[model samples]
Target: MRKRKWSSALLAASAIIAAAGCGSDDPGTVSGSEVYDTCTTSIADNVPAFYKTYFRCVTITMSGDTVVIKTDGLPPHNTYYYGSGHDKYVAFDFSKGSDYHPNPNTLKQQNVTIQIPAAPKARGLTINAAAVDAKVNSSSNEYGLGPRGVALDGVSLFNPLAAPGDDIEDEKYTFDPYNAHPTNNGAYHYHTTSKGPLELLKKLGKTTNTTPGQAEIEVYGMMCDGTLLLGCKELDGSAPAAGLDSQNGHVHDIKDKAGTVHFTGRYHTHVCTSIGSHKYTPEIQYYDTCK
Candidate 1:
């Protein structure tokens, strides 16, 4: 698929339309380095079936041994961060109570391109010596406060780390119901469970359950280092059988909707907090190489 270029008139019109809380039923097709309005692009049919179902309004293609996914780094769902008058904007869920202070930052378009290993391998007992040891050198590969991974919904996933001189536990209070918030740079991201992605999967008939349960298997997303992120259950709606490593990771063949092996003997991590599991996306890098 060729990327379209945005003309000056389209940019100006999109800005006006967006501020007026309206967008085209058609994917806004204006082309540019950044996507400022609606996402009109489509994932290539040759892309993995898993991504095709989840990564809507984004572009996915293979580059050598990696799958390059390009997105605007914005949420397609409604949120207070979308700002008032924007079509995707909605009031904050005050059900979390009066303490839910919306962060100062708002959502914006970002030119983000995520490249993940096309075929990932399991780092058995002998890990990549050059890579930061997820078990021993935990501090070295800690996830920075940026795009650690891309969600199926095209938003970014941040590490669980708080800003300088702040506690992650304290930061939890600021997260919306989707367990996501924008950074100071206007980059919206999720550090934990995302109700939005789960709902998207359910809408696609990937799973039936919405709330946390043993019957709901959830594929959260993939990390930059080729680490697959899953929820409390496996693809078959079964709980994890083996103990996860320090990074909440383990290795096995994960299958797709048709029971075909999607990832053979690959490494992935679980970020299910619903079952009292404290795991989140690894702050530390474990793969030998990541782009």
Candidate 2:
């Protein structure tokens, strides 16, 4: 009888060990060179599954109600910003336009870690609330400049607003082929519609379109307050429903082209330049809690 009990206990221990090992071995797709390595698949089970499955070029972990994301903040694609010596570097295309000129800053790896609520709440009543903290202020839904969120390619997403006295419309011409540029400190980020996120979807076999506004389905990234950055169409490759706010945003379920539902009643904004007057990243934060 003692031998039988020992056998059962040993089996239980083995099962526990297997379960722990399974978390990191979750079919990760590690892509990229030494410049920017992307490890998207081998993530802990505690992290939200959507981020684990769809996102690339970052390492994700969860701590209680907060989701912690760590990335080098270097885009996994070719850019003139990567500098000439790097493998990912490309010569700037002078043919893009007469107004389009490369910014002086160069791209480099960044140690960026952002913490956000795993399950964010919408600010229905707090829409008009007073400000307290800039990171999670209620009154000020305005996104502060610099590193608002992470893009699909592990790049940073800045708000639509440019620096003080600098015109954002003018800055759009400074973006590279992927529609992104670096800050004065060398932090590369996306400010408007880009082929970066759409290209990732195509690489993952999720879609065939890679164009910015013309893609079949385009999704940029998640903001601190759980706002989804979408393109011309919804995730299912259909037209965005009517009644989008002035910011070209609305609350709805976020699903993929394959009919997999990722979030329910989520706030998402469209940044498609082809469809409407709004043609840049979202300015106002829709959800209540950011941290």
Candidate 3:
């Protein structure tokens, strides 16, 4: 990712949100040797093929049992959020919906670190109180004004929560075509369904002629606490099985391209609004901890 100076306004906004940071350091600065010392295989070298196919402009590596992902939080598509002079800038297309309105903030690069377990488990674990307060509220499942996960296009994933006295459903009016909007600090994030990741998948030929009814199992990204986020279907193109918990998560064997099982019986959440009732990314942390 490119390095850029953090604007003073952004720095002030960063003080209010936890996911804010300067894009000065390159995520790719650490060499292979420096990233995984004494561990012959680098994390990026061993990550499942799906990650390589989905994630772009980011660095992935293993730090012991955890996978360390460093991203410069910026979407790869055109949006009015990119502002007028930017090359990727595109005026917001108001034809999609009448409620479409642009937020005042513009897109700014962010340095974000996501750490997830290489092999996540169900364990039926409860999030610690401290982590809960830092990330979200335990009762309402409202996101704590920070990143809960990361999207394939290197954008952050926030839970379905709005600021005090504001409801996310009401805030949806401000979203761009991709169902994303930046915070006052310029932290662009997804609270619900994101067309950006789906568009990336389609462009990569990972999906073809997909519809809401016949949706395929698509990987979006992973949460900081080791939970994997998926669309409406499983990797095998089947609907998610029943018995998903409040977080829209369950333990199951994840399959690969050849129909071979990987991450056997691991915990994952489905944010597939097309196929399931849970339309937003994980609002509650099913795992015990997150960094």
Best by lDDT: 2
lDDT of each: 0.66, 0.72, 0.65
Candidate 2 residues 56-111, lDDT tens each? Answer: 77777788988777778888788999999988889987788898999999987888
Select the stronger candidate by lDDT from 1 and 3: 1
Q: What TM-score quantifies how close candidate 2 is to the native fold?
A: 0.80
Question: Model 3: per-residue lDDT, tens digit, 230-253?
Answer: 877777667789877655677788
Q: Please count the clashing residue pairs in each candidate, in the order shown.
A: 6, 2, 1
Superposed model 1: Cα runs more than 4 Å off: 1-38, 121-138, 212-215, 274-276
Whose TM-score is higher: candidate 1's or candidate 2's?
Answer: 2
Every model's TM-score: 0.77, 0.80, 0.75
By TM-score: ranked, best first: 2, 1, 3
TM-score head-to-head 1 vs 3, winner:
1
State in Å the error of residue 53, model 1.
3.6
